[model samples]
Target: MPVSPRIGLVGSQGAYGRWLRRFFEQRMGLQVWGRDPVGDTALSERALLEEVDVLVFCAPIRQTPEVIRHYADIAAGIERGQLWLDITSIKAAPVAAMLSSQAEVVGLHPMSAAPKSATLRGRAMVVCEARLDAWRPWLEAFLAASEADCVRAEAEQHDRVMALVQGMVHASHMVQGAVLRELAPDVGGLDAIRPFASVGYELDMAVMRRMLASNPAIYQDIQFDNPHVAPMLERMSAQLDKLCDLVWRGDNVARDQLREQLLERSRDYAGKQSVAEGSYAFERLGYLLADLREPRFISVFLPLDRPGSLRALLSVFEQRGINLDSIHSSRSADGELLFRIGVSRDGDATALQDAVRAIEAEGIGRVLEASGIA
Candidate 1:
């Protein structure tokens, strides 16, 4: 472990692997190599062991412990003083396997999907430092480069928290999706029901859809590979049974029990400030959903990344006296920066169309979509 370690990724073809590859190369200016079983990676296991100072296991959770164990056996005493790290959903087993290796070991869990950005800015990262002697400074430097809100935890503690945060939440949503699928036909499928959905319903739908669209293996591994998840699921099931029984009773005593168990007792556990913060967050999200649902908006992609590009685009709308309701900018999954600008509902549609034409004609921005207009 020098001032900058040459990094080796065990699953460099995967989503988080690719993201970390870019972060190492562009953000930290580090030399890197990767070996993936599914693809033809540049480095072999032996090559990675010999070449890189830091080895990161980014393989799926199910394969991670075995991967670490294989590497540790082959590189016995050879990887001593080198750093071994893993970015997996569950930490206990992988961290344990790595501790058996000669390398300095740590388990990392980033609290997000591979983002479009180069760094994990504004996101949380859990660090389980199993062993560190000489590599401590470099590890701190690496974490600093990531710009994550790093929280230190023991490997066992990390797995327990993840069981609640990821396992229980995902299980509940998956069950909700099942319920929706079974009963949607009674009210006409999702498309028909979505129109009348509350903001909370729409928010949950977004989370459920995101899980469905991603690689099924990632979610499957989270549920199965983590040992703590079974107890979490059992507790969730028991709570549902209690609620169901309370609903069936349909009496004053049942109502009191529901209030005490579901509301009062939980609120006391969660604390007043936490509930207040959650309520305010809900209101903010409700406002955003309302604005988006209006559909009187356009998405634009500006070709130039220069300063005046956005102001010039705004001028085109100003020229038409078309006031915007809201404007938001975000990067696409592929990293293209795009803007979504909402038009006032009462604004003249023809003027907005003219603005779109002018912006494109003058090369200010290309309008991607114009929803909710004739």
Candidate 2:
């Protein structure tokens, strides 16, 4: 029977590092050791190099290449059966450095952050095999046990995909936040109008918020360190310029042609069924208009501006089985709260009336204008 491989992970103090260490120790019940240059740890570089059958660099994107290079001699001295792997977001440089070592090298990018749930059951993991001779079976079995969807790609291919996937996407969010700050200079300026935001707008803002809240250095490294990102950003800028020019001209015929071309390209890229399911633009305007016409809009005024009031009002609608098609809330000039809510005409009229009365009776809000009844 083959002996289980002893694993050593570098940078075990970071978030991803800690998560990975716990996963290997607690979940897999593997004999795992860790080494952090800055953190107080028992495992030294020499100890890890001499003992572990597999060494994984779990350092930041910027620091990974240096770590691989620093330990290149130690890795080269390892036995043929041992392996060296890196989990950097960018793969090309680190993979190239790891290939210098005599031991088999494999680059693993877990296409996601550390595991938050019970299992990494269906997450995508990109495996770039630099020199996987003796360790191929071992790595494959480990991935299989973890239930990850392992995608095999060349190092160059992985970096190219990440240049767009991580690089361009992050750049777009940063640019958007900068533009928003330029437009709204005050603190909590854009968020102040969040109550009036549409679902799509809210979703976009949520992604922006999440990204902005993360460590800036990490995003900066992912964007700047990727060699293929500069060209991708240039292409993205050209496309943006083309759209800007078309919009500035306000040419309806040209805009319509552009829209059709874009839709066709999107359908080609994502497949017809996926585009149809995901796009609201594909829906006929007449059908949407008909649905809107069948809804009775009820506008209410709530004096309270505090939190949980909105949830309370929504709870009333939920209990009454009033399906709210649209919700628009804003603060009046005199600092009062105004909410315009839409419910289907097929809904119970008595129940809707009761919901409105309950809010007023509870002194939460009053009915300002109840239209669309006739």
Candidate 3:
């Protein structure tokens, strides 16, 4: 009979820890040992080297970096071949730490969670092969048994992609929540009702809900620890500023040319590579409208300074059968205003802004910004 691998899990009570414990016992048919003395089970971490064939670090993202190195330091002192693995969201730092630990290491990340007895069907798990020859077969078997699809990625690639997939998405929803809180409309108002909620609003709220339910520490670690996020965020901010200038100056021709230029650049970028295993194109244009959720709408900004401008904007939008989600506004240092209006997909944002410019009535606001709304 084949001997079962003696597995030691450092964390036993947390959500992921419990999920993994059951996964190995029920699915992989492994002789899973809990922390206990005199039963070939490790009662403490110090005794891990005696019985464990594989040590699984199933700690939260924030705790993994510190705990991985701590255990790795201990493992490094031992003079035997032991397999170590960490299943954490952020991969790069832990991979580096494990390399420093001098133990046979592998990086694992389960793409989705079984918050409550969720099966692994159609889910993805990223596997970083630090020691492929020794551990690959067993890892593949484990994943296959669990009904998970295994995808191989480098440590840096995982981190960079996650910075956008998880980090930026979370950040965008956070900004949405902040905007809603600042506005503070009645919870029972029309805005809260089903029919009144546009796709963009619903999608934004859904993202916010997911973010709110997650561990704050994980969000903080993902946002601050990743090194690649800053440059991406800066580029996005600069793009927004450029869009703002185009709207403010009423340069419709320039704006159209710039939009085409941006789209062309996106096409060029997307042509170079594949994402999620060639399943999806990798480009800014395709992903840009993802945040909007309803890509058919064009949003216009109306300065709050114009007393009746909001009503007028809505009237024009309504006449044209445009879907207006919400108006985003902020105050400037010189008492000027910045406004972001969300409208239906068919309505041309540039055309709407041009119409507003033609109105040119006294105290009517200029279009400060406009963009496609998903």
Q: Candidate 2's error at 266, in angstroms?
A: 3.9
CA lDDT, every prediction? Answer: 0.91, 0.78, 0.66
Kindly state the number of residue pairs that clash in model 1: 0
**Candidate 3, residue 169: CA error in Å?**
1.7
Query: Model 3 residue 318 lDDT?
Result: 64
Higher-TM-score candidate of 1 and 2: 1
Q: What lDDT would candidate 1 get against the real structure?
A: 0.91
**lDDT-based ranking:** 1, 2, 3
Give the CA lDDT, 0 to 100, for residue 76 in model 1.
73
As a whole number from 0 to 100, the lDDT of residue 242 in candidate 1 is 98
Selected candidate, larger lDDT, 1 vs 2: 1
Instruction: Compute the lDDT for candidate 3.
Output: 0.66
Residues 269-289, candidate 1: write the lDDT tens digits.
999999999999999999888
* 278: Cα error in model 1, Å: 0.6
Top candidate (lDDT):
1
Candidate 3 has what TM-score? 0.64
Return the lDDT, model 1, position 152: 99
The TM-score obtained by model 2 is: 0.71
Q: Looking at model 2, report the run of 10 residues with the lowest lDDT sum.
A: 282-291
Superposition error at 149 for model 1 (Å): 1.6
